[model samples]
Target: MKDFNLSYGHWDLYHKALKDEQRHDEKVQEAIKNNLAHLLSEESIIMTNGEGMARLPVRSMDEYKLRYGSNDSSQVGQGDGSSAVGDTIGKLPAQSQGKGEGAGDQPGVNYYEANVSLDDIEAHLFKDLELPFLEKKENGNEGEVEEFIYRDIRKSGVMGNLDKKRTLFSAMKRNTIKGTPGIYPITRDDLRFKTWEDVRKPESRAVVFALMDTSGSMGAFEKYIARSFFFWMKRFLETKYASVKIIYIAHHTQARVCDEEEFFSKGESGGTICSSVYEKALEMIEESYSPKLYNLYPVHFSDGDNLSSDNNKCVELVKKLTALSTLFSYGEINPYYRQSTLMKVYEQIKNEKNRFFIFKDKQDIYPALKHFFSVKEKATS
Candidate 1:
């Protein structure tokens, strides 16, 4: 007779597998973060309008598992040797498509796409972004955000909102007052319940004017890139602000205030006049969105092909806008890196509040967003 001993290492196996999975997830997260710009520029995400899933393609790192009789030659694609020359014989793995002898050397397409919700994407993105300069508004809606706070302790309220700790303290104090100080039994009168009140948290009320040039020079690529920036900007504003408003202005040689749909979709074959949009923005501000009550943000996107005569007017309007606006910015979509006449003219306008950005490709959209909206840190003394 032979003697044998057996032991089970189930926990060790489980631990190793768990660690591998965790590492893989961390790797995927890093990849997603690195490629966030590309992901943000995807047409699917930009057009989603904050609904549905945003699929992310991430590479898998787990080792393939094998099962008993799985992919068995006897049961899979194998026949009784009576097959025709041209007959189909099932499919082959992508990595196994080559007919070269010996082991294959080419890399396999091992990546898989994970569905991430729009809210998740927004959370990952908006957590790091905020308006450049947000000022407190004192006009309507005293503060920008309303928060419900539970601080007041009442004698009569719902049982679910009972403040047990406060009630215990009350009971102890009452017992102490009654000369039976130590750990006395609680009474109905000692019961305390938490009450809440709506608090208006102080924050800035902002109105953003999204101005875009819809000239023929603003081709499909330029339009898409511009829209991508505005898409994220709109989402960011909605996610972070409760009372903030965004006005859309689209212009070619002429400027017009239209609905969001017309702003993004309308195109015209005409000259480019960058100043018209700025004038429209100022008009809108004077008409409804007051600079006193609203921290104005006027952001313009164009191909920088404005008429030479209008350049000075654009600069003057921008200066006027900067006087009232918190932060005024310009984004030029110059794919060819050509020195736009308007860009050259904009460079002459010297003001801390006036900032201009140039993006040649879609990937630049994320960095542009960060640059335009990143929260500025206070100076340390």
Candidate 2:
């Protein structure tokens, strides 16, 4: 008979058994391996003592090796979506005992176990990681929750030190009740003081979306800047908002969706129809997200060098997107030496309110992001 405790590490029992026996047992070794594999197969494995000590399972350690490497040095290090996939090994759900040991002299039943995969575990965990920091406050009348990205840091302060400081101050204050009677006139028993009030500050929630053209003319520099911009903006939005969902669309003759990895690394080399991207984004917003419910913002990064007569369609697309989103911005990453005709069409939109932005280089991204989230003077003051 084999005994196993989930609290202890897998190798712990194995090594102990081996040291005691001094001889190798092939069957026992195989059983241990199978036990570990079964543990790995379990989804949502949480450690009793919560911390980074949790085991995150990946499809296979071999898969991780292929993407990164077998060596610890080959870790993807740190980035926005680096730790996205993994298997989490932890405790099993509580089970209740059956009423009778044997079913009225009938045979006993053994329940079969279902093995879970790394992919299944990752998909399960991703839902929790989606904006874990922000707490939701339900809005009155509407079912929609008022989402804020702010954190209440004061709620987790050191109370022990605060108590000691308060006690010392109280004793000092009592000694001076009769007006600055210096020296240790106050007794420790007379010391009575209140605890410090916690501090909390309001944080802003702003979401900025970047739609970049990955076509050939943009060059390596442009692509790099675009990836960095998205990464930075994602980090910033995370601080202020309860959630941030980044959608990447690469359009040439038409627009199709891409994940973060494909969006940053994929290169461009096809005819341009800028309107296709806008249309798809509009559909996505309508299907998954509503304008008033979310802090909606859309930014399009493209070269001013679009097809000669497609400007009208582009303007129509802008109008459609602006209607759906809170603020729509067009950032033209002009790298080629061509006429800036793209700017002209967007400029004619009549309404100057949050419509277009044309930039010459990468340095403009910061300012452009600021402008995108920047409130008007009346709104700011």
Candidate 3:
């Protein structure tokens, strides 16, 4: 054993195996992409305690095993035992199905669980979505503010704005020009600093009004679907716009402004007054979020179980709101409440199909969201 000659072939094989494993993992993610709607649903989220990390059940690779082929058709116990067609040869213990306790040595079908973030789930859900009619409006001086933009570099500035690299380069150049070999002297002029210009930048701000009907008729399933839609909608808005203000309004018999937690979780028992919520949202918009200053989005979620009397009022309010809003989206979340009075009212007022959506189940959340945010290309004359 004087000298041991080791080849680097094992290293290449190891890296190749790692690449293959990564590819397999990517494929698994791609497979799970289609199931994002289910993953982002209320049921899946409730299982994870509303946490960001959700354990998603994924299909595992099929396990293969090499077996020896037998020449004889029947080998009874490797000897002389024959079994009937309906007779049980052996009994195998039942395996646990779900997230249960205890572990066993029994071999069974393998499954993979992927831990994915809510953001990732949203990204998948809203991958094809975009805010429509996001045209920049020239709102007077109210929208135009003096913003400090770093556009110019100067020889003089405050200590905080010193361009150290540029200053150093200037000092080095001056030193080189003066033929100073020993000392690297920095002159007053050589002290270059970054300068900022007070430019009047027009800021495009967006205000999202998330209205939900928390009436008595809205059961757990109804509330859950509404919450899921709002949650994803808020997340999608934040991702798309830099300056976005989200206002949550929850209504039962009466409409009231509430925080996100209260908006989604509060269980209010009363009659459904759909117009009240729209009125409150409109009032808020008129008072604070002006259409000229902000890109308004009035997104309402309901079970389509509003009072028959309130339908006309709701329609009128929606028309008024749509006049000011950049985009108005109304989502009806009841499967049984099909062709409902509230929906019928909305249909009459809706300018386009994408403006109004009917979500029957959790699977419809993604498509509804896409429909809400999608900008339809105007047909050329």
| lDDT by residue (tens digit), candidate 3, 1-381 | 156644332221123334345554564467558776677674656444446466666455543677775664432243236766677664432432244656755567655666666665765666677777775766352344466889888987798999989888888777878887422677798887888878776657778889899899999888888888777777777766666789999998899999877776678888999999999988998798878778888899988889999899888888888889888888888777458888876776636422888878888887787778888875454
Off by over 4 Å in 1: 1-25, 52-54, 63-110, 137-142, 149-197, 377-381
Model 1: per-residue lDDT, tens digit, 147-211?
88997888999999999898989999998998988546999999999999998766777889999
TM-scores for candidates 1 onward, in order: 0.69, 0.47, 0.67
TM-score of 3: 0.67
Task: Flag regions of model 3 displaced more than 4 Å.
Answer: 1-17, 42-50, 61-110, 140-203, 379-381
Instruction: Give every collision pair in model 1.
Output: none
Q: Write the per-residue lDDT of candidate 2 for residues 1-381, one digit (tens) a residue.
A: 256644222342233333433222333333334344233222243211111122422221111134433563323234455344563433322233344665554434422223333333333222222221122222421233253343322323444433445455666676678676443554646444333444434332333456777766667666655665565455455544444567778887678888867876668687777777888888887887666445557778777667768888888888877776666777766655454677877888864345566555555655555555555443332
Question: Lowest lDDT 10-mer window, candidate 3?
Answer: 7-16
State each candidate's clash count.
0, 10, 0
lDDT of 1: 0.81
